[model samples]
Target chain A: MGEFPTVTDVARVAGVSRQTVSNVMNTPGIVKADTRARVEAAISALGYRPHASARRLRTRRSSTIGIRLDPMIDGISGSVLDRFLHALTEQADARGLRVLLFTATSPEDEISQFRRLNDGADVDGFVLTSTTADDPRTEWLLEQGIAFVTFGRPWRSDDFTAPRHPWVDVDGYSGLHAATRAQQDAGATRIAYIGWPSPSGTGDDRRRGWHDAMLERGDVSAEDLACLEVVTADGVDQGAAAMQQLARTAGGIDAVLCASDALALGAMIANPARVPVTGYDNTPIAAAIGLSSVDQPVDEVAAAALELLAGEFEGKSGAPSDPAPPPFRMVTPRLITRQFAAIPRDSVPVNALVSEVSR
Target chain B: MGEFPTVTDVARVAGVSRQTVSNVMNTPGIVKADTRARVEAAISALGYRPHASARRLRTRRSSTIGIRLDPMIDGISGSVLDRFLHALTEQADARGLRVLLFTATSPEDEISQFRRLNDGADVDGFVLTSTTADDPRTEWLLEQGIAFVTFGRPWRSDDFTAPRHPWVDVDGYSGLHAATRAQQDAGATRIAYIGWPSPSGTGDDRRRGWHDAMLERGDVSAEDLACLEVVTADGVDQGAAAMQQLARTAGGIDAVLCASDALALGAMIANPARVPVTGYDNTPIAAAIGLSSVDQPVDEVAAAALELLAGEFEGKSGAPSDPAPPPFRMVTPRLITRQFAAIPRDSVPVNALVSEVSR
Candidate 1:
């Protein structure tokens, strides 16, 4: 936080030549103990600290943490992983660290990359994202005693297995819970949920948020099970089709909440009758289209993750000696309400929409 | 290309043990000249290349390239930059090189960061994005004899300077030229262009695309100049507002084109009639809403940039002895058509849209 202690400062305080200070700092064993002691005392008295980079040099570490960029990008509109990488790099820089970006075809291949990079001393640790059920990479990293933190909730193929690694995730359950409760407060009676099919912890947790909120309202109906819940693949098309199906089957759905902005965007596009719609992940598209959505504090999540993985968790957790899981962080999410506009019209044919309309 | 030639293969061809081949390769001068010549002959005979990493270590280069991530991100819905980064990482990995991600507060600050990282031998070269007029960083890089290639066309602020470095940019001029011609082909005589106000090469290049196509149609009128071109600051709101302005000034505008999907999305949102709208950077939002956009083959740009910067350009163009600017590549762009549908009404109130109603 203050000016870095220079060799000149040390020499001035210790009444020694700058070379002696440099010798004491870089090769302390070569210096006479008393002279080295005097220089060290002067450094402490002046409240001067050496450069962090120099301290890391003594450890023979690269002072760089590696992050793997998945070869496949899911949605261009929701580059949550990219945003996390951005924040992590900035936070790492502030700590005199750098980010090493690598790519791997799969989780197993990622383990190999970790081995290769570590063997070459190219990276000291890693940051993981989009962890899935029974993640093989987690297992491999744990076996190798590699240092890392996941930006997703840990899943072990079963709920009984407690997480064994450090992780930081957006609290989607609470985010959607509040979103649904807000709709209720705003006089929505029959709320429907549109989300991905289950078995994924993230999807299930978000759907639970809506279910619990509707239950709290005592507006839960048996029809909610068969008629309301629409579980489909992820995308605006799936979401729109799901909403259309829900409208055809069940009559009185008033408010809709989606697991993603993609779903909400789709729902908004196909909304036959005007309906209040909310989406998760307040992506730029959601904002552009004026859809209420949950905003994950991506920067905070990255900072917390770097602090836990690269700063503190490295020394304490995810170590082979301690086979227990590290404490996890659940970053709170916020809601942005812009209220989607109704586009109440049948879609025109793609070809006819753009034609020789005389100028 | 071929199976990486092993020491065994070289030794077998040289009629020597693998250990002798290894020693000859590592410490050739220490080995007898006759034996070294034999090993060298065998290496050539087998098309054997020494480990690139070991060669890099001997040269004291990190075999890593730097890419600067601006502290602020523009849009989540169309992270063209993020996509470009993803492709670059994959391509770099293929070349036994890694990418170092850094952040900077300004273009000038990026120059300092480049110096800092390079001084540490952490990176051997750089890939610059978003190059703008009178880019101080580019000037600094050239003056310092740093190795780099930009992913954007260079500009000297005066508009007379040819880009003075190796670069790979999508042919936005051609992409938009074709897009405007498509509209012209479709019978829309009066077309409007919405883009950023500029001395920027990208903005200017795209504007020229539209202007040129319109010129091909006939002599462009003064009224056409005033009403058909709208340039403003970036954002959906600004774009929406700009399109509204154009609509008010010029009637019978049948088609619109934008420099970015954000602007096109805005223009679509505020559409007073069913006008064919197009956007650039075929982002996910463009696909979701079916907005026709120009697709910049990002993967191709990344590959071409790395090919020029890290591959051939490194050895041939950026040598300290030769200070001339390297060659640049312009990958062709493609147009994707997905006509946007008309919403057909003013937005309903957020509350009114949520109220319970009988079907």
Candidate 2:
């Protein structure tokens, strides 16, 4: 019930005028350095709070970026998304920016929300993830001339009108190839692929890698591997059902490669303790379960996406004649081998000493 | 690429005056119902976008609520947080409000960020989670006369100075009681409790429930139980080590109770075929693993919190007083059981089949 200390309190504490205290907060560089320091110290002491809503009203800009998430994938737990968002959040904070969140059930709904934001002038920019190759929303964003960066590349290159659209993509094909080759190295003649293949650019790339790797092996025929084509947005259920079906029907498959850690976790749980499951996206769940998987550099992807969007926001589109295409920034995933079969037996400690790296 | 549509286009299409079109978009009640319908039809046809920001600037209200999260917990995957946030976001959208996110690394940093927002004139109100006992920031908010609703009750009653200060919390202690009692029903007397004890009121509450349930059980004594307190913020490794220690030292513990699904997953993976583990929160991982746990009603909590906050913001104090002394709202939780235990022959089929009501 105590009255809050005002600007006058800080002014009296610092032995400066109220105008000087205001300058320290609003235009610190304009004030003498020593005086500004004293003013700041006094302000800290009094716990003075400035009215931000009124200031934003005066400035006519909210230094906040609105992020819209597709709801279908919202069911996919945060274990996969935490690292990427955390990196983005930390970096955004460092740049004196904040994030606004919008959620939509479908592509059309997301576009409507985006359009509303554009009309509202509520945010300065946007960051999008899990984009499809032929996504209609991307075209709409381009039409509105909104600055955006996506985590995954769109499947259709022809839909892009903004020659300098920025995106951060994982080398999905390369990661799958490495996983398949690793299985082959471990004396496996045929490997089963459990994944959801769609017009999704990443999924297609992974399928291509599996196909190419099998072809390179020569001994394994296309018919030998099981490809689960039905991909549900509710990936956990889909993965569980897919694994259960595979377990009931498949024969002699030594290793399984999954497109996501969620699917891999489901596959592992449903494996009846017989088969080895490998997954992409080294999420915390995979680490906890001791499933060997490819670690997509989520931190790197988030950083690159921000840098690209920041560049566009800063008006450095890279060219006037023909803007240089934003590089298809592909982060190579590292193979993170844990308690599964990758490590040598000698390295397996007899004691149950838990590793400190928790996700 | 095309010029944006204007009021003239809408008027021309609708066969109405330009003013009528404006009224249809902004103030529909002024226009005749038929005329309003015509104008709306025309606007949709032309893909007309209204200038939302200009109107907000004119009105001096953005209709946005600021949300601040603890950075350590913020890193706890968007997927886990999404359920609660999605609920809040949807509730806000239903009332035509937006959420602006402000991330802060610590409590001290959050105070400064809050000050910045207040001075910057950005947000109308705040929705804060992680309000610990003796929260200094909550006290500061009251001192500044800002509108805020904490997700939980602050520890110190004196901190609840603002007449309009409101809070919404999950019934953690009661849910924990249910979970413990359920384990006891399943013939688990020597139950091991695993989790951290800290600012997370939920963790502490669950511990209290476990303590009370054990004390109430005449068959179980204090010496028969085990408590694995994970001091590290890094949960998975801490959980694994803690579980390993409990598994080694706790001679007669029949079951394990976890503060989070993350810990349960770790324990399950580490022991595989040994102990029966139950988790709180019933996160997606818990579902995938079929761990019997308590399910927090995040949606209900979010809706209740928003309703209470909105009531306070509308100049209504003593609004949430429920004719009870505690002045607290509690959301009911459900017990989710899966394949964590060996069901009796008669119980196996019913439990194995997903409940018809659930379906």
| Winner by lDDT | 1
Q: Which fraction of the native contacts appears in each prediction?
A: 0.26, 0.22
- Pairs clashing in candidate 1? none
Cα deviation of A329 in candidate 1 (Å)? 0.8
lDDT of each: 0.74, 0.64
Model 1 DockQ reads 0.14
- Residue-wise C-alpha lDDT for candidate 1, range A314-359, written one tens digit per residue: 5622222454546678898887776456555365332332232211
The per-prediction CA RMSD against the true structure, in angstroms, equals: 12.5, 11.9
Number of backbone-clashing residue pairs for each candidate, in the order shown = 0, 20
Error of 1 at B39 (Å): 37
Residue B352 displacement in candidate 2 (angstroms): 30
Q: What value does the lDDT take at residue B306 in candidate 2?
A: 80
**Cα lDDT of model 2 by residue, A1-359, tens digit:** 11235677879999999998887765554788689778866755554545443233334345677787444343334444545666777778888888877877788988888878856657767888778756788877765566788887765543244333677778888888988888788787657777664755777788778778888988665665444233444365566667667656665567778888777766654565446677777665555446677877877887888787877676522232234565557688787654442221122221111111110
For all the predictions, what are the DockQ values? 0.14, 0.13
- Per-residue lDDT for A254 in model 2? 74
> How high is the TM-score of chain A in each model?
0.77, 0.72
Error of 1 at B49 (Å): 24
Instruction: Kindly report the docking quality category of candidate 1.
Output: incorrect
